[model samples]
Target: MNMNEKRFEEAKSKIVGIQRNREGIGTLQEKTVHAVLKNYYAPDVATHEVSLHNYVADIYTGNEIIEIQNGNFYKIRTKLEVFLEEHPVTVVYPIPHTKWLIWIDETTGELSKKRKSPVTGSAYLAFKELYRIKPYLKNTNLKFCFPLMDVEEYRLLNGWSRDKKKGSCRYDRIPVALFDEVVIERREDYLQFLPYELPEEFTSADLAKSAKIPSQTANLVLNILHFMEVVERIGKSSRSYLYRIAKDLG
Candidate 1:
């Protein structure tokens, strides 16, 4: 097997062993995705869930801290502020590159057929969460790790909509395999997100087309990139704003 595949399998094995021996203690009680990622990033049991300052780190490698956050960035703002003061921190966020949806009937305990989601995932989705913590992006010690994976999402048929899909609660996301990883540690690392076909000055719609992401996501991506000085607001193109890569970045 390839190195990444081998690493993923090893991580899964580690989590299984922990649950079997520890009786699902502490972070082991977390969902499969979080547990697997914690082990995948740092397999050493010694480094898993180390206490630093007043917060518990998901993984501390002595030199750096790795936090696996599967939810909103707002929750980790305080923890990050304290950690960033003394050590470099890399926040690992998982995105389902490919997702299959399975819905369970809460009353009958019956599961519906698994269906693939129409929307594909991308690293650009991170901008939504990153925007919440824009103030911290400038810190040299702050880094981001986005792991793209194939997943099976289990949800309950407990939504407000007619089909019961809207506003549904996700029961769990089981990671099937690791596809790839995107690590952003420096200002220059943001360059990979911009498409080569983009013009010197482009609108969010233009970026949306090039990046193949929704216009809303493109706007959020620009918001973060603009704050980082990776892109500058050059001018206005009608109702839309025109943006160009910062000359320094170019």
Candidate 2:
């Protein structure tokens, strides 16, 4: 092999070794679920692709498998379908917060900021696919790990882009499942950071317009923000009152 290829292999090996040593720190997809449980659930569990079986999932919460889906959802659907046929586990795969199909203005093969999600129509088919493997899933002591999950935590956590003025993701929650109560505890920060991508404050009107949601929904969001003192009515307009997110961190 050429010197460059050899060097590349050596680097890759080092990264793998590091991953093996620090199993808690997983990939970007796994990190998404880690963030989820860290935020909502108190007790959580996650695992990186530490070993090779059918394949290593990003995060496996004890209740189910939480995978941060980043690429072709169908390919993951296929792999997890096979794995579920063998192992006893509930699967949760999170779709990233990519643009909705309505926003896509580009050609099918072309990539864009407005890429559409492929899994929207057939989420239930994923469950039906499990039945096709029911024979395998029926094995009790056999550790039936059939069935996979398609979690959308990555989509939820997409607000952490460095370009944004705020809302950076914290890596505090990993390797665990968080109950819903945790979300209640941090609701304010949740909205402030909006761990997942949503309409940025700047685009509330445009997004509301595009989604075909009534301006009332936008007003509702603004009201919720106002209740939290995150925003307030600056004035009345043609439809709704103006508001802004609160600035106090405490």
Q: What RMSD does each model have against the real structure?
A: 3.6, 17.8
lDDT for residue 136 in candidate 1, whole number 0-100? 98
Query: Tens digit of lDDT per residue, candidate 2, span 29-118?
Result: 434333442222222233543233556655444434434332334555455665565454433322222213211112332212423445
What is the Cα-based TM-score of model 1?
0.90
lDDT of 1 by residue, 1-250 (tens): 0237788878867664545322332233588889898888777889989989989999999989999998699999999889999999999999999999988787976778889999789899889999989999999999999999988788888999999989999877777788889889899989898999999899999999999998999999988888899999988999999999999889
**Candidate 1 weakest ten by summed lDDT:** 19-28
The TM-score values for the models, in the order shown, are 0.90, 0.25
Model 2 TM-score (2 dp): 0.25
The numbered model that scores best in TM-score is: 1
lDDT of each: 0.86, 0.35
Which candidate achieves the best lDDT against the true structure?
Answer: 1
